[model samples]
Target: MHDPATLELLRAGKLEILGRIVEASNATLLCSVELDGVTGHCVYKPVQGERPLWDFPDGTLAGREVASYLVSAASGWGVVPPTVLRDGPFGSGMVQLWIDTPAASISDDEDSGAGSGSAAGSGSAAHREHVEQVSDLVELCPPGAVPQGWMPILRAQDYSGEMVVLAHADHPGLRRMAVLDVVLNNADRKGGHVLAGLDGGVYGVDHGICLHSEPKLRTVLWGWAGEPIGDEAVEMLSKLASLLEGELADQLDEHLTIAEVQALRTRVRRLLATRVMPEPSGMRPAIPWPAF
Candidate 1:
């Protein structure tokens, strides 16, 4: 969990635009936020820069991003980073703490030893191994050659017409994220959104297209479909159901419509009743395009 002070800074701080994330569909800016001698990097997505979508209402993506963060925090999963909707240099937008992954850390410190016969060397080696293992949470492998514990989602021909299978690791953090995605009604849970945090936690990002009233779930996490929901997830969902009846509903209302909030409640109740992981609905595409 992020410290209260850090969240407060994100909510109320001076932002300086460092650069733009060129690959993003929206005007996502890399920024440096500072207040009272505290400083950190963040991503700022101004509302005015959002591209209009046929499905989602214009200028509401920032609110949905904040709402997703709230739900993640309430679930005690800490999957989403600390995010806030506040005015930036461009305009009012969503500002989120930048998560530094193991790969980024390793690249930033070139002198970090990985082969020495010391405690630090052993730790470095472990960190490198973690980075290597998590670098491909979702990937294509030779047909029927899925990793030991990984789950295959689809099999199709690659660019060169070679047969390959798309799969993801059977990881606990990813399982929790899949459940969270169900709750968020996330329409775009691409593999790239899943981050292996340097602090040994999994984080999800880019939640601008979530919390819709309709059933628009699209993700690469169908590995646990039809399996019984875990005990911890059941308890979390029950607590979330109660929270929706009380304070959480009001909080979500600031960002989502009344119908949308109610839909969220109904989804939680339905999950509690079903007690099993959901499968693809077949009404729509189960996974987002460009899966990564």
Candidate 2:
């Protein structure tokens, strides 16, 4: 239902500014967009609103956002929300449908509930007994300590002065998103950028710094690093690699250089060949700044 409306509104919506996203480092605005008498909320990031980046050329973030969406769709994981590049009141920009993030109960215990998996840096265990109850959802952070699926993201002191770890669920959808990031060469995938929709959908946004020719993948979804890529994800990667040679490649050319487009194809093929999740190259920090 969201796919068609998202495309329609983004391409022809009459945009009306609702407010600015003050927390965003770039020029991000919230607006009400109307198209063919239908109204919806969306995020607008204008080209003129972009800040200069030493590596990325100026005023190209909006296009990058659209490119990211294309890659996401090609992967067939739908990790990214619907995004399109169009002209707005502020000028040319990327307009994306807004995802409402209402809270949901992950567990019966209120204390075990988390918010978008960004509040704490680490996935700390409140009690060892709790791990046994939700063992299906989590694994040990340290080998031989907790289990296999657990990857610690943050560590903090509890009120009793005991250190606790905060970790994210290493679920299938998230693992797919991680693979999606690798193929796109996403440079900035902070925790907060991962949104939870009211309908139990997970989305990754703020993809303006993706698809660089250089290997600049920085993300918080490194929990599965070095793990063998699952059969389903491997199949998806294979599908995207084939699609890139055709329509996807042509579409990307409008937003990226020939070299960058080729690089994207190369990355996908390499992942398919390797058949494993990649470890940090150590060229840069594996995690993005401000982690959340």
Candidate 3:
């Protein structure tokens, strides 16, 4: 759980490198950070660890990560965890308080869209079993099916080479996250990024590619496309709109360009005026690669 005092500690903590996340593509590390007698575990990603992207400025991913946290706070929904920018052992980086979760209750079959192998050969028997456990809870509708409670996210092949459509249950927090994503223009919202928190809440992470001035809002949460924005979310967006002119804008100015911040405010206004969930803009791929 991320309380205000804990967040302040994370912002101004002394970090000790515990270990490196070898599996991560970039320079990601696990650290024990302490401040004012408060100690916590955090994931640290240094600026030097970032893989260079053609579209984004070098060493700016850490800033974008902090920006995402600000947007999550502005939305009045604690979707993104508490993140802060600080100098670490590696260098200046982004530090996020780690969230512990039970073995993920959701399926994360990383077969690259099927045509791969059997579940046993796929090396994810546990995940396969979990998918089966939820078979009754989730109705696998056919393509083009838009049930009242389900929204299609992607299509994948099952073990038997059968087509299986993956959809998410319509939830309130998820809807708010979708609105937050639109405002941040998040370029990467993978299924694996959504974690079932130990606090019994859903949270999103790995927002290093968000808040660019460009329209890079690719995600897997398009099930609510064209749906009307709920009143609660609209009110939150209105409040966020006002904050963007003052506190939010000031914090973002430290990380993003003036144009990018302006673009973010523009998105807030547009979402509030429309009062509807956004549809795929068709400007780019709607789903991020390795969606889950």
Candidate 4:
């Protein structure tokens, strides 16, 4: 899907550039176009390596997004689905099915706490409790270690605290997303990636820059730290473990090396042990600062 010719035409045509949202790492847009008289809408992601300097072996940012979608769809995460890219004038271009819905993001507040520098000076017991909570969240990560997965993607207002809902607590999807992040070694799943449709189904987006065999974990949901791995989480972990030796690997083979697959297997095994959360390392110390 990393064809240069197709991409040039799409770039030149500027097909459906409206409603473009600029992310910290890439640009997302709700695009509409007519392909052979068939009208459709798709999300276009043009690579913008403003931070961490996009180092993946491919063309612009679109390819990475497509890769992420491929990996996720293969693993049954049901993230963005990858459409077939084909021959064109500029190079091969990508075409993906566009999903429309009301989406939400997980990020930090600009008003106070953590990133505001108050976290370091607060000496109250309440502050200490918060600090401990933060520490526990870092520890809750899967052991495989994703450097960017260490950041918290959700704020207190983003959860329910009763049953893992928005503005409440850690939903199962949040944990599942975490699992995907750890397995894929995803580093850019911010609040915005977790989108909730009007129908109440939450979907995750933007998975480019994944499949690394390193500790690239980073996110903004630290509320569940120190919380024991619930039965639900364990079941999901087991499901993921089983996937490693089957269809999941076959799907990953396209973009990921065998070493990457093995590394994923190792992460599954390490996370399989109940009651143990991933300890902080690599980029775990960085707080989610709402870049997009």
Candidate 5:
């Protein structure tokens, strides 16, 4: 599931806080971890910093984050990055490997490119290309102008009351993420959580509010709703179902309640039996608010 070396580094490395990710609802720190001459940046969310949620248990968001990573890894999709629950400068926390997206790297280099006219022009073009790359994954567009091959998830009026649609590219990686979200019972699969990594991986992060014992599958990835689950996903689901019966179940129990673990198994089996992407239930809102 995880590269053993990286996992050990996350578990044992000295964490030096680089900055705080204030945008997160919880106290999320961006830190650089070093161990055995190795160094890498990671996001660390200490349990003591978690905001209380009425639905989920207090002080358990960090474990839930790790649990989600476990499920993703066991599913063989690795949609989530390597995450571990460990002691940090603040306290016990969830530490996850930071993935670099194209846009982030471009912004980091903006100052260097500003010095020369030719370099600035090239940088502008590169920035545009990276923006388009991100837009391809998820975007808001005029209701009548959904991109070719993109799936529309919602049609709503913006602040100006103008009609717009939320959609995402019809991509296999995103399809896998959608399926993974269903399994996690993810309550917040916002557009910003779906990252297009510079290394060409589609990753999902911010999984602190997942794996509830109830059906809370809010997401912006409803393009494949009601469609048949593809063969690859079905095969993976079969493997996941098997994993739930043994060691995987044991590992999850450390971070989740017995009820939650059982619920996860049930969800996987249901998906395998139906072989279809689930439609949103009318009982609750199907997408998370502030979708971006």
Candidate 6:
């Protein structure tokens, strides 16, 4: 829902904010947004003053998330809807529909450690609670277990509720989007990021860090890391490649570069090749301090 007057209202903060939502990891602003036509109450993340986060400029995280959602949609994946990106009293910020799903673990096994798909950095009680809650929301596969990076459910925020565990990463469409998240280097796939919609459709949210050529492919859904890319996945990527110059391409072109798309394809190629897992080149072997 893109409305000029409504956007103006939001810009002025004239649109009354309901309550004080929790601060996000990246943005410094106290984030609570208005939901015009999108859906439920949304969480708006505004950029802070001069010195925001060290990685990007103020409002950069929200803008990047908006851009990531756009690209993911172009790839034919279902991600959270980023309605507006305005530069008003809040400077440059984005507004997205706030979803309501409990913080639960989608992992089949016990919560051994933090998930790999976590973007930014994983230490929030919200994320941990999400993993824990998902344990009961959805059913799991008795024989299969998800790898750390390839968490089946990706959420943006954290809540306290029953978690919806999946039946092994069996759904083709779901896994396809998971692959896209990895290639795009989506960092914040907290349990709340993966929303269950009206018609049993799962939606991804919080993608401020996406469409980069850098090897920032951090995620909790790594179950397939050591697995070979099946033929079906190859076909999907092929279709995505073909659409690179079509409608999807147009949308992605605005936020990403040609090289970035190529890199996405490259990731697909690697996944489809053999069973070689991607190793992190992080300076520290493990998640550094300040992660907890």
For each of the candidates, give the backbone clash count: 0, 13, 0, 42, 0, 44
Q: What's the lDDT for residue 12 in model 4?
A: 40
Q: What's the lDDT for all of these models?
A: 0.84, 0.75, 0.76, 0.49, 0.86, 0.47
lDDT of 3 by residue, 84-185 (tens): 998888789999976544542212232211111221223366655543433322234566674667777778776688887867667666777788899899
**How high is the lDDT of residue 215 in model 4?**
68
Give the distance in Å from residue 85's predicted Cα in candidate 6 to where it truly belongs: 2.6
**TM-score of every model?**
0.90, 0.81, 0.82, 0.58, 0.90, 0.57
What RMSD does model 6 have?
Answer: 11.4
The per-residue C-alpha lDDT of model 5 at residue 134 equals 55
- At residue 161, what lDDT does model 4 achieve? 40
Instruction: Identify the runs in model 4 with alpha carbons over 4 angstroms from their true place.
Output: 1-19, 27-29, 33-39, 46-64, 74-168, 282-284
Model 1: residues >4 Å from true position, as ranges? 103-132
Residue-by-residue lDDT tens digits, candidate 1, 1-292? 3668868878887888878888788999977777786666678999999999999999999999999999998898888999999988888999998766644332323222121112122346677677567755777899768899999999888889999898999988899999999999999999888888655567899999999999999999999999988899999999999899988888999999998999999889999999998999889999998787
TM-score order of candidates, best first?
1, 5, 3, 2, 4, 6
lDDT of 2 by residue, 40-110 (tens): 66789999989999999998899999999988877777888889999898899999877655332222221
Write the number of the candidate with greater lDDT, choosing between 3 and 5.
5
- How displaced is residue 250 in candidate 2, in Å? 0.6
**Best candidate (score: lDDT):** 5
RMSD of 3: 8.8
Residue 62 in candidate 4, Cα distance off native in Å: 4.5
Model 6, 153-269: lDDT tens digits are 322222444343332244444455566675566654443345543223456666765656766655544445555556655665666666665776566655566777677667756
- Relative to the unseen true structure, what is the C-alpha lDDT of residue 186 in candidate 5, on a scale of 0 to 100? 98
Higher lDDT: candidate 3 or 4? 3
Task: Count backbone overlaps in model 2.
Answer: 13
